[model samples]
Target: MVLSQMDAGKALTAAAAKGNPEEVQRILEELRVHPDTLNEFGRTALQVMMMGNAKIAGLLLEKGADPNVQDKHGIAPAHDAARTGFLDTLQVLVEHGASVNLPDQNGALPIHIAIREGHRDVVEFLAPQSDLKHATVSGQTAVDVARASCVPHMMDALFAHVHS
Candidate 1:
């Protein structure tokens, strides 16, 4: 019941990474662990949630974890979710006010990562936003990445949106 600060932080990080909502809530309520606390990797509960842990992410959000918090890599929760093609997690974060256009350390937004990684669905989800046209650290836009990666479907989707 009385976890040391380090133990509590590790437990919270584990819970978030596992997407265990009940365990996360138990830790927060019983252990009084701060939900927004960052892990050793500079990833918060929300950032871990972006790794496809929707349940834990939702629990953390309900407990007042800041959705907008960026990791040391400058990556928002949405970026992780998008890169991994976790649309459900991405939607939850977005609904909770996660910025889809938030860039990473290299200035790559979620949409940019999605395109480069050949995640067409994620690209589709982000294409409607007017602010996704920005370039990454290498000066490549999402469309450019898609084209260069030879992801025809992704490129088509992006072209449809960018040109329309």
Candidate 2:
């Protein structure tokens, strides 16, 4: 009845991948799956939840998943949520203590990716939470990336938040 750690990890990621909240709960409670269990890519369950499973993600956090645990790309679940424009998911991650300004391997933060991908609404929502003045490893600010990536509305949004 008890699965090994490897099996449990597989089940956990599978449940999260399918966005199965109940199954995730069962896995956490019954199968003894660690909430921070990493997959082959070094992504924890919370990071996998960035595929858009807010419910499962919440359960993972409630079970002690570290919201700021970075994956292979050196970013956390919030980066995936931001990249995909999943505002609700991103908010959940942040609410669970995911650091907003943590940059990835490319020195791109969640806000930077949001802007570059033209998620204007996400950009608007996240810009205030961003340390836009903080330059990336490449030395580009969120505003600079906005201007360079041709996301004018994102640029405008960042500017508005700043000037306001």
Candidate 3:
């Protein structure tokens, strides 16, 4: 079925948000919608997609979705995945060319968000790939975020990566 761009965006974004990979696939394959199509809210499927769904993340990315697509807040899929502690989904996004160094509106990179959110696994995955020197608008780097997170050993985890 042919769907207008608006309808297609809505349908595709909705399917992604619901974590229904099959429905997302059907919408993309059958509807022929662009993988980066924006919903009515001006957000892409990747932006609103369930962060825990690595399968959906892979499918959308395999279909050519923009891994770096950011929302109005400048939060990309990687940022969302880090914030939500979905390391697998984040890895998929990074494999699809998402940049761990991309900053949000607050100048916080994915690593910064992972540290602040106490997502140690996510932080570890991003640590080697991220520019550890980057600082947020608030002047916080991954180290600073870890210090404030109060999550025991968060700093040690970052230190392990930093030293190596």
Candidate 4:
């Protein structure tokens, strides 16, 4: 049962998006599909993968998926993980060399997203790795995001990593 290139790309991305690491692994190994294969929509498996599934993230990454791969919007897997509060997945991505400081088209880094979303744990994890002084397109830093969030814990967590 051989699949066309398009079919294989679709299957790979679909399996990743579903968080089925087994299926994703099978598609990559059995189909000889590249881990970075793009779906018909021009998005890679990592871009659409389940943000909470660190296993899937690890599998894709270990198989050569680009850790820095980004969507047209400049949103990387780390950004998605941070947005979804999946600290484990974000950690896996960073371990694979994803840049925590990579900003999206809006100049929003993963830390900014985590802070704005009130994910204190995620913010804490990202704080040390992210450029806290970097501003978003709107000229807002991570501190500004936490301050606007009105979440004291978020500020506390971010401030804990800030040297100054």
lDDT of each: 0.79, 0.82, 0.91, 0.91
Give a tens-digit lDDT track for model 2, residues 1-164. Answer: 98877677777887898788998999999887889886665566776763567788789999999988886679778788888888888878888898888989988889998888888878888888888787888899887898898755776778877743
TM-score of each candidate structure, all chains considered together: 0.89, 0.92, 0.96, 0.97
Candidate 3 lands at a TM-score of 0.96
lDDT of 4 by residue, 18-133 (tens): 99999999998888899888889988899999888999999999999998998889999999999999989999999999999999999999999998888889998989888999
Comparison by TM-score, 1 against 4, better one: 4
Model 4 earns a TM-score of 0.97
Q: Give the clash count for each candidate.
A: 0, 0, 0, 0
* Candidate 3 global CA lDDT score: 0.91
State each model's C-alpha RMSD to the native. 1.9, 1.7, 1.2, 1.0
TM-score of 1: 0.89
TM-score of 2: 0.92
lDDT of 3 by residue, 1-164 (tens): 67888889999999999999999999988778888998999888999999999999999999999999988889999999999999999999999999999999999999998888888888889998999888899898888888889998789879977752
Better of 1 and 3 by lDDT: 3
Q: Give the per-residue lDDT digits (tens) of candidate 1, residues 45-106.
A: 66665367677777788788887788677977787787788888887788788888788899
Q: What is the RMSD, in Å, between candidate 2 and the native fold over all Cα?
A: 1.7
Model 3 lDDT at residue 138: 89
Model 3 residue pairs with clashes: none
- Model 2, runs deviating above 4 Å: none
